[model samples]
Target: MDHPHLPGPAARHAPPEHPEGTAHAATLASFDRGLRREARPDGPGCRVERTGRVVRQTGPRHAWNGILWSGLDATNADAVIADQIRHYDALGLDFEWKAYGHDGPADLPARLLAAGFTAEDEETLMVAEAATLPRRIDLPAGVRLVPVTDAAGVRLVTEVHERAFGTDSAHIGRQLFDRLASAPDDVAAVLAMAGDEPVSAARLELYPGTDFAGLWGGGTVASWRGRGLYRALVAYRAGIAASRGHRYVQVDAADTSRPILLRLGFTPLTTTTPYVHAPATVR
Candidate 1:
């Protein structure tokens, strides 16, 4: 497959420069290489593999299974997609093929839909310079952000996620607990509290070989919306990322958080949608 658009190894290793778009592309390339090179079958039972130009990722059975860092041309797209579906089907694992706007072949999305993959919500790949992100955000007088350090803190984060998203967050809580035990410095979770009650929470995952650190699960309880709590959580995580030598912070922004992320200096580089393939048993 032609990888004309994919960055070469040298480009992936070079230091990123500023202006959000430049940083965004550099960080995306760096992260793609990092995922293929450094991601291991660690805590989340997640493992990555390289097949031809496609990078496949499989995680815990209950969690998401997916593909990443794909660079395919018209000649090979069909075979690559078919192989992925067959491999996952044999393993009885439902998987997602993550398609980014800048990905090659231009018609990969249409092909995926024809092959029985269901498109999920489209999200913006938002990126910002870590140093440019707001460092100090004022929370409501009584509310404060706290770093998660124990099971109680994990539970607090889970509670805020559940309440904010209206769904069970046990899976995320479990992953957070395991990550803390194995690579505490690589990941950090924070919770916003109004005295004893948790109001908002988020997690940051720092990639050692890349310039980007990812922000995930920044959800605030509905009652706490519009109070700057979400932005404060973002500021706190960006500070952490900067302290750890990460040059940029990236988030997969949905409707609720996209505007807030934009206001905080994040620029949308591309849209990504997950094309899911589930076996009949799963469907």
Candidate 2:
């Protein structure tokens, strides 16, 4: 299923005057290295490995299992992809091969499709300097933004996610909870609520040795849309990223959040699509 919170393809406003090429290179490099080194063992059942230029992440036994940061040449792309598929197949795991617009061997997408991988929606890779994001976003009259700490907070976040995206977020919530328990300072999960009811939620992942901090799962319930909650969440997460010394804040924006991110000074670096291979079913 398409993640409903994915930001759109169009930018509502003109992209700001930023060093587009430089920022894009830096963000992508940081992401490749940072994710390889920092985003591993995300929860109890998860693990990450580097094979050649591909970073293979498996388990949590959820939808996030995939191969990332692939930079293979034409000579080896097919073999490498086949190896990955066989490896995951042996484990009975469904996985995705993430393809970026700027990725090499430009025919990689075609190869994946030919190999029976189905493409998900392509999303813009939005990035910006943390210090450049707006900081003073105002919340609606009854809405309040708070950092998630306990199990209840985790539940609220998952609730908002399920309602906003129409998917079961229990796995995501469990991973977040595990991260918070093991490395509290490395991750931040925030929730927005009207009185005592949850309405919006987002997460910030701080990569200690990299220049980027990632924004994930930013979503608001249907009734809460257009109320500035999403922007507020962005600003709030950006503030945390800046304080943590990250120079850039990056998000894979879907159709819904793209415009909001663009207006807040994020540049569209490139587009990324995940080619998924589902586990074969028994007849």
Candidate 3:
């Protein structure tokens, strides 16, 4: 059996940008608002803000995400942040974060470490407002683009991803279909084809809660490489976000494709590194 790593073909992608209030940071701010999607019945659990924590019970099991500032003295900081962690613990979930480096909470890492928490992995946060993005992208020949919203379309996406990312992830197809079937308007998957065959794929998850829509799993087969299909797919996703009132789109990019994202008006806010912690005995 294989252990799960930093979301290889399935992990969510995040990028860091300034506080949403800034003009250059409008996109992230916009998506932040979009994230207030139809809330799940079991979310926004309790928080131990004094301890710097927020936990949601309805999402992934043992999962939580939050931020903190170390400016306060130890007692005050722990009082604030620890209360939040306690809330997450009450929910019986795991806590995690895809934090950026330059964030203001200077002593956040130490706080988390002292609280029995450990850094899972790091990933650079990236952002680009839709207004600042290029609307035009040239698709490589033989690659057909389509907005898929069904099971068959999702299967093709999973297959392309398996080939490109070197992992078997049929679960990815299920997740795509679930999201598409449940919230077609908020999220969309773009498929790039070579004569009816899906050769590349990617997903755009629009977070109306903040000004950030995320780009994830954009994978192209070796045969489909160098055709500009990937960039075209990204543009397609961005178009969807723009249409839905999202102003920014971000991606946690790998070295191979960082150049392409940089060309698309995306600013590298920070570098994100993924660290894995699978048991020595694979589960």
Candidate 4:
């Protein structure tokens, strides 16, 4: 069995190369490739395209959250990006944006600061080799980890998720569980329990499309922290991934959990930030 982290069938539509770890030019080239899938609406000033759901800032001068790039058109360059920002602002999505240092024109980040955007904490892009990944961890405390497959179990995961992330995302849980239920036997969920109560929980996503399977939503209760539950869950997930023929595991991690991932043989390669924009204004 391959490790869960390996790229597999889950990625049939993905490009041959992910624009990560490449030098400036190569990286842009990689993004250019993905452009075929997600990029469009090229022009001066910013416009919301993709059925008006995505905000596209052209001419290379906009502040967007976490990795949104602006075109570096020499004419009206900075203003164009700023127009994109203001346009999004008009849409009421003026909270904050994150951009990777290596994306867009070389000076994009600096320009974003000049436009009132702030640089917050930076986290690592971690990837793990699942084949070498370890499993066989003992449950910490009284926590009993179980593989969830039923509707009730899925609801348990959703409950734990809402408490942990401060969002009413039951729809996401439903989607995950539905996929898991319909998902071939290779993909699975492992929920951690404590005395019949669902506290710490996580899920494993095995992509038959790529050599990579992702481990996501490892949430533990406050009291459960410092115990080995999270690590054990990760190990458990990794073992399942390994058994499913995956080799690489990737996660976009937050600051609080960076060190733990580092200790577990995950390597930080690059950072990706999510840029959020609302409807209206730019439309």
Q: Which number leads on TM-score?
A: 2
Off by over 4 Å in 4: 1-101, 106-122, 184-186, 281-283
lDDT of each: 0.79, 0.80, 0.59, 0.58
Error of 2 at 171 (Å): 1.4
- Misplaced by over 4 Å in model 2 are 1-23, 36-39, 281-283
Ranking by TM-score: 2, 1, 3, 4
Residues 1-283 of candidate 1 have per-residue lDDT tens digits of 0001222121211222336566566667766666543454435577777776788888776665778768899999988889898889878999999887777777788888778888766677778889989899799999887899899999999999888878888978988898898789889999888999999999998877777888988888889888998888889999999999998888888766877888889877666677789975677
Residue 45 of model 1: what lDDT?
74
Output the better candidate (1/4) by lDDT. Answer: 1
Q: If both were scored by TM-score, which would come out higher, candidate 1 or candidate 3?
A: 1
lDDT preference between candidates 2 and 4, better one:
2
The residue-by-residue lDDT of candidate 3 on 1-283, one tens digit each, is 1112343332334344444336545543433333322222212232323322322223444222343222345446556556645655665554443334432244545655555555554545567777667778787766678878788899899899888878877767766776776667667888887888888889887765555677888888878788788778877888878877776787777666767777877776554432222222331
**Between candidates 3 and 4, the TM-score winner:** 3
RMSD of each candidate? 7.0, 4.1, 6.8, 10.6
**Cα deviation of 63 in candidate 4 (Å)?**
25
Ranked candidates (lDDT, high to low): 2, 1, 3, 4
RMSD of 4: 10.6
The superposed Cα distance between candidate 2 and the true structure at residue 233, in angstroms, equals 0.4
